[model samples]
Every structure is written in structure tokens, then in C-alpha cells.
Target: MADAPLRSLFQQRFGEAPDLPEILATNPEITRLAARGSCRHFTPDQIDPAILETLCAAALCAPSKSDLQQRDILIVTDPGLLRDLKSLLDAQEWIADAPAMVVFLANNRRQRQLQAWHAQPFPNDHLDAFFNASLDAGIALAFFMIAAEAAGLGCCPISTIRNHLKEVRGLLDLPDHVFPVAGMAVGHPLRAPEISARLPLAKTVHHNQFADITKEEVSAYDTRRLAGADGPGWSEAKAKMYASPQRMDFADVIREIGFKLD
Candidate 1:
């Protein structure tokens, strides 16, 4: 039987968990998928070509902005390239072990070509264009992760792709208008990753009126999360992490890569 907390998670996902009609009350598939979380420890089993193709297909099925399918996925099977990228990304050794790694890109170049071929002026040629492509890419990445999990696979998104943006751009031979939004490493799971604590839904959901946040709400979250097995957790950890603002100069790198986010 699904416990209250687990069932509440399903409910919180879509505004409220609906009671299943008598006939379809329990779905093994959804229950199984909902149980998933990230997986840091992975087995060495290789994913087959057919499955990889299916995963990519599912990813691309994600909604695109204005039907302008401006996203691409680069499947990296090359060991040498992976090692080089690892070195560039501060040598995070865990990255190199994953059997498959893929870079998801925001490809604005295609739209530019469409403009040229159709003899149209690519008028919105400033920051908005870049932002749109990046958003599109991010949506695709999210869909891909959810689809992969639903298919009984485990994944970890590596935003560290930005840490070595220049190197990755060169390695992938990405054109000027194509930027790496994120990378994903996939494999079979050895064990489930830690279930990181989350703030209660009440803390986040806003009703009809824009609710003002109170100190009590914040304190309540801190106390509730810190009380679990993953105790000693506090919002201060997040504050401290962001306080110094490490890895803050990526805009300069973005410009260097020919994106004029003016």
C-alpha cells in the first residue's frame, strides 16, 4: 500500500493527487516511476543503440517554442573526448565512469538558416533569441530525464558542462549559434541516490492572491527538513554555497562563443 507521504508526493506533483476511479485506482507503472530519484552509483552495463535512439526520440517529442524545433542532442561514445572534457571540468572523475554521456544543445543556428533560405530578416537577433533557444533546450532536457526514468533508467544531469564551455564547444564542433545547455550521464543503477529533503508544498504554492512570505514559513521549512534522517540540514547551507558566487563569469564566455547577449 502506498503510504501517505508517497501518495502526497503524487498529489503535490499535479496540484492534487486525484483519487483513482474504482477500476484504475492503482497503476504499477506510475507507482514505480514515482519511486525513482537520481542515481549516482551505476553499473557498467552498456545501453543498446535501439534504446538510446528511443530515448532521444522521446526527448525531441517535447514541446518546442513556436514549433521551431531548435534543440539537438550529441551522443558521446568517444572515450578520448570524455577524458578531455573531464579534465576541462576540473577533473570530476565520476563523470568519466558513466557508460554513456550526451550533450544537449540549444541550436539557434537552424532558425537563422531558415530565415536566410526563406529570404526573411532574422529581426530578433539579440538576447531574446539566445534566451529562447536556451529555454527550448532546457525543456527538452527535462523531458528527456523524465522519459528516461519512466523507461526504467537512471540519469544525472551535469550542469558542469558550462564549467568548460569553450572546450566542449570545440570538442563537439558546435557552431556559433549552438550552445551546450547541459550534459546527461546515463546507466543502469547500482543503488538509488539519496532522497534529498524538499520544502513542504504549502511553502511554495501561491493561491489566488500573491501571498507574502513570512519568517515563520521559512523557519517551518528549515525545521521540518532538518528533522528528518537527513537532519542537520538548514537553508544556511544553500545560502553559504551561493554567497561567494563561484562560477559567475559565464556570460563573458558566452560572448566569446559569439552570442551577443546584449
Candidate 2:
């Protein structure tokens, strides 16, 4: 039955099949979630702006932080603006292939506006404010991906948009307390995407008490994820990535843009 397909996908992703309940394993949406993957290749065909409009509307319906609704989306259609953004993210070569692009923003500024409009004291302008806004934006981005994928669209989130935060903020004309969370390259898929392996459930999912991931677990995971690839293992790759001094000023820079982050 279709349940076998879901089990197979779980095996591929986690190297261990799920003992899923039949009803859950058979649900099309649940199966789709298990098989989710990012697509960086796309055809030259363009997507209708209307589809994106509906997707954004649905994505915004996702849960928010304390009903603050501190998130917004920028649908980039202008050729010049898209070109500038592509130039900034050129390192991710496939970004240029996307027929549609969208930038998700964490907009804490709206909450600030609400306080000023009602003549209320804006006391909570510290770390929690920025954290809440960022979470709202992140949740909306996840919702957008799910909605887009359901509509047969492929997308890859580019967090590198934050690497050049100064230039991007300038280009997007983002005011204080509004920050770019990520950019998404969207289009119809040119080919089926391969699922990237993930950590085993034992390594991630735990009981009420938190559990730490052991080195052995990660080593086993690295072997599964790097089976065919000749690249470094996950730990080494991540270590190299973190060695860079890039974006060390991220918190400080955000403070300059109106988040006290105290």
C-alpha cells in the first residue's frame, strides 16, 4: 500500500524505517512531509503571480508569537531588483534559476508601532522581542514551504541573505526592527529532488528529560549521509563552516537597526 512508500522514505531519510500507524502513514500530507526535499533545479517556465499570492495568504495563517503577527513577505518580481539579489547570493549558483523569489522578513517594528499608537510604554524591547519576531518569521517560512510544495512548486531557502545584511537591508528598504530572515528561490521542479539524510530519531527525539547526542550517534549518521558523496562528514563540514568570522556582528548590527536586544 502507500504506507510502504512512507516507510521507505523514512528509511531513506533516517536510515531507519518508522513504525507509523497505518492511518498516519497512509495520509497523503504526512507522506509528503516525510519525503520533503529542497529543489534547486527548475525549468525556464514562469509561475503565475496569483499562485504566490495564495501561497503567501495561506502561509500567513500559520501560528504567530502571542498574536503579534510580526512577519511579512516580499515578492520579488522586478528584474533589476531580482538581479541585485541574485548578485548578492551568487555563491549559491542555482539561485539564479528560480523563476520566482520571495524574501521573508521579521517585522518587530509593527509591535513598536502598536505601542506608540496606543500611547503604551514599549518596555519589552529586549532579547525576547527580537526572539519572538524571529520565531514568527521562521514559522511563516516553514508554512510557506509546505504550501508551495503542495501546490507543486519547488523552493530552496537561502539564509545567506543575512551574510550581507547591510546591503540587503538597504536594497529592500527595510526600516528598523525589520530584518530579513531568509530568501526563497521558487519554481516548478525540473526533476525530482533527493532527500537529504537526517539524524536518527534516537539521536533527536527524546523523552521529557533532555538527552545529549553522543559522538557515536553522529558518526553513524555521518556514514549514512555521506554514503555516496566524497565530501567531508557532517561534523567536519560544520566545523569548517563555523570557522569563518562572517556575520559575527549580526547581533550588534541588529541593535543598530532598532532592536535593543538587551
Candidate 3:
């Protein structure tokens, strides 16, 4: 049998593609998932608030860990407020053009409040509390992006919001334990997003036992990335990014925000 178009997309994204014929029954959602990319350029067509609200509702319907429901979404509607927030992200030029933006949050405050309401002591102050909330936020973010793309909107996830955590929290009026995981730029697409390269499934997906990646595997992957429009090889680009201390103080900021990451 001929390889599915989804397999072609996977090959485009990862260089090496997995052949899973049994699961190759393609659908609209599967096609979108297979061809997903981060859209940076956007047209200035204004988004309807109702559409964004529906997207958020669909996103939040995603599975929560033990139904803790720690994730939330905040839409940026005010032009002036969004402008101020955009000022902090001047490095990203596309922010000025995107018609709408939303911030995904890890809101563990509600869970803690449940304890206060029930007159029960909140004993689990370990790292898992913070980890789980952050994970939930990420899951919702993924869902939101998928839904947005499906709805014919482009999206660019702005993780740099964490670089200005204190300012973002102040600007958005985020209270304790309700931290921004990431922000998304949403609007009509000016151009189609390029399929980003990913590490091959061989290095990423393992059998029952977990395995470490080999340097040769990474170098080969880096070579594949270099052959594309990306200027630097994957290893060199990532090494450069790691060299610059972008968010080393992130833990300190989150720690101050009432996450007892013990």
C-alpha cells in the first residue's frame, strides 16, 4: 500500500517517518495534527470575541489530571492593554500585527482554595503540585492551537512572556498561583506556516524501556535541519540558545508567586 499523506507530512517534519498502517486512517483532525506549525505572520483581520470564547471553551474541555482543572485562558481584548503587553515583546514584530492574543495560565489557586473551603489542610506542597499545573496548562495550550488552526486561524505561541513574568503578571492582574504558561498570537494567516523539523521518532519514541539519544543521531538530525531554511544546525542553534541565560531566574519568580516547589 502507498504511504498515507500523513506519513509524508511526518517525513517532512522529522526526516525519518514511522510506518503505522493500522493507524493510518486519516481524518481532518489527524491531517491538521500531522501538518501543524507555528505561524508567525498574520493578517490584521480582527477576530470575533465569540469565536475566541468558543475556542477557549473547546480547549478547556481537554482532559485534566484527576479533574484538578488547574488551567485557564485569558483573552487580551483591550487595544491599549495589548499594546502595553506588546511593548514588552518588541523583539517579536508580528505581535503588533496579530489581531488577537490569549495567555494560557496554570491556576493552582482554585485547588488550594478548595482546601480552605473544606477546612482541610493542603499538605501536598511538593514539586508535583507545580509540575502538574504547568503540564495541564501546556495541554490546554496544545488543544487551543489545534482548534484555532482548525478554525482557519493562525497561531504563534509566545513563550517569551515568561521572560517578563513579573510585568506580565502585573499587567494581566494575575494573582498568586495563577501564572502564565505561554501566550498565543491569533489571527488570519498572511502566509502558510512552514513545517518545523523535529527529532526523528527513533530518538524520541522508545519501546517499553526509556532510552537516551546518541550524539550521532543528534548530529544527523542537525544536518537535516541545516539543509532547510534554518541558518544554523539544530545542535549549534540550541547550544547558542542554552549559552544565553534566558530564564534561569524563572524559578525564583514562580517561587515568589506562591508555588511551594519543594
Instruction: Please give the CA lDDT of all the candidate structures.
Output: 0.76, 0.91, 0.89
lDDT of 2 at 212: 94
Residues 83-180, model 3: lDDT tens digits = 99999999988788888899999989999999999999999877998999999999999999999999999998999999999999999999999999
Q: 1 or 3: which has the higher lDDT?
A: 3
Count clashing residue pairs in model 3: 0
- In lDDT terms, which candidate is top? 2
Worst 10 residues of 3 by lDDT: 19-28
Indicate the worst ten consecutive residues by lDDT in candidate 2: 17-26
TM-score against native, each model: 0.85, 0.97, 0.94
Ranking by TM-score: 2, 3, 1
Give the runs in model 2 whose Cα sits over 4 Å from its true position. none
Supply the TM-score for candidate 1: 0.85
Tens-digit lDDT string for candidate 1 (7-123): 755554433454555444455656655556776677889888678778989999999999998899888767788667666765566765677877899998999999999999977
lDDT of 2 by residue, 42-128 (tens): 998998999999999999999998798999999997889999999999999999899889999999999889999999999887899
